[model samples]
Target: ELSMSGGALRTFSRCVTCLARIGSDLVFQAYPDKLELHTLNSSRSAFASVSLTRDFFDHFHLPADAYADAAPSSTPLQCSVLLKSVLAVLRTPTSAIDRLNASLPNPQASKLEFVIHCVSGRKKTHRISCSAESDVQTLALDRNGFPSRLAIRPRDLTRLLSNFQSSLQELTVIATEPAARLPGVDDGTGGKAVELLSYIDPTKDDYDSRLHTQLWIDPAEEFLEYEHAGDPVDVTFGVKELKGIFNIL
Candidate 1:
C-alpha cells in the first residue's frame, strides 16, 4: 500500500499519461524503495520511463507476504496494467481528494485498488484490473555521451513552436560554429556556437526556398555547450510528439 497527498497523485497521473502516449500497456516495477513505470512506442523509436522514490509518497508499504517468495530482494514485484484504466480513476479533480491509498494485493493480484480519502470525510474506492502479461522495452540514454546540447528554456521552445503550422513534422537541431551571413536574423559570428532549429518541409516549391522557418539560438548567450571535436552535431525529432513529451517533462 502507498499513501500520498492528492498533489503527488496528480503528478503521477500526468507521468502515466506521458508514457501512455507511447503505448497503452505498461509495466510497473516495485522495488524495496522505488517504483518504475515504462513504455515504448509502436515503431520502437521512442521510449519513456519514470522512477519514483519512497520520498515521493507520505507513506509506502510493501507487505512481506505480497511477494511470491521470501526472497523478494532478488526479484522485485512486477505488474502489467493498462494506462487508460489507471488514468480514468486518477483523473479526478485534485480538490476532491485529501489523500489516497493505493495497494497491490499480491505479486499475482489481478487488480490494483486506490482508496480516495476526500476532504468531506467521504471515501471512494476505485480498482483498475491488471493485465494478464506484457512486455516493455528498456530505454537507456547516455546523456553524457551526447556531444551537442541545447539548453533553451521551455517557454522559448513553446513560443517558437507556435509559429510553425501543425502540418510541420520534422524538427532538426544543428550546432554550428558560425558562418558568414548578413547582419539580419541570421548574423553568424565565428568562435560563437549557434544553434538552429529547422522546420523541414518537403512540399516546398524549391529546395533552397526560404519557406521553411529557421530559428537561430545564440548558444553562448544561452550557455549551450558542446563537447564534440568535429563537425556540427545534428539530431532530428518529430516536432508534434516531441512537443507533447517536452511539455510533460
Candidate 2:
C-alpha cells in the first residue's frame, strides 16, 4: 500500500509509474482521509480530504502552461470523484499496463480490487474454501482469527502495526546521517523515473533537490510472504540492529 500525495498530472504520473515499476498488489485507501502535516520548521497541523494522487490529477490535470505553478491546497477532495478515478484507472488503457509489465513478475495475473466489505451492526462469518491443491499460495495480511487482537473495534491491528512500523522508519531516517535513503530505494528506472517523489512536500524549496537514502533489509521476510509457516504473527523489529545501522550499537 502507498500513501503518497500530489496534485499535478506529472506528480501523479511519476507515482503511478513507480507503483507500476514495483510489484504492488493492491492500493488501499480511506475516504475523507486526514493528512498529517509538518512544515520545514517541524510544526504540525492536519487537513481532511479524499487523499490519493489519481483522484487529484484526474480532476486537476497540469497543463503545459501551468507546469511549474503550485498545486491546489485549498480544495477539499470529493469522494465521488475519487471513486470515478479509481474505476477509470482500473480499466486504464492496456497499453499503459503493458508499459509497466516488463518491470513486474506476472503483471497479467495481477488484480487491483477495491475492498468494500462493510461490517456495520451485523454478525457475519466469511469463509474460504480449501484450495484445489493441498499446498497452495496462501497470503494473509492482518489476519486476526479473533477480535482480541484488534485495536479497539474495527480498527485493524495490522493498520496500527503498520503505522507503528512507519514511526520506526521515520525514527530510523532521523537518526541516519548524510540523511537516510535507507527505506525507499528508487528502482533505478533507467532515468525515466519522471523524477517526482510522492510523500514529499512540493511546496518546499527542495522540490527538485535529491536526497540521502536508506534501505532496510529483512533477511527472513520476502515480498508478499514470510518464510515462517502456520498462524499469522508480527515480527519483532530489530531495534538493536537499527541502532547499529545508525552507529549507536
Among the numbered candidates, top TM-score falls to 1
TM per candidate comes to 0.73, 0.19
Tens digit per residue, CA lDDT, model 2, 116-179: 2122322222221211211101222244443112112122223323333332422221111112
For the record, the alpha-carbon RMSD of candidate 1 to the native fold, in angstroms, is 4.9
Least lDDT summed over 10 consecutive residues: which range in candidate 1? 178-187
How close is each model in CA RMSD to the real structure?
Answer: 4.9, 23.5
List the lowest-lDDT window of 10 residues for candidate 2.
37-46
Return the clash pairs for model 1, or none: none
Please give the CA lDDT of all the candidate structures: 0.72, 0.26
Taking all chains together, the TM-score of candidate 1 against the true structure is 0.73
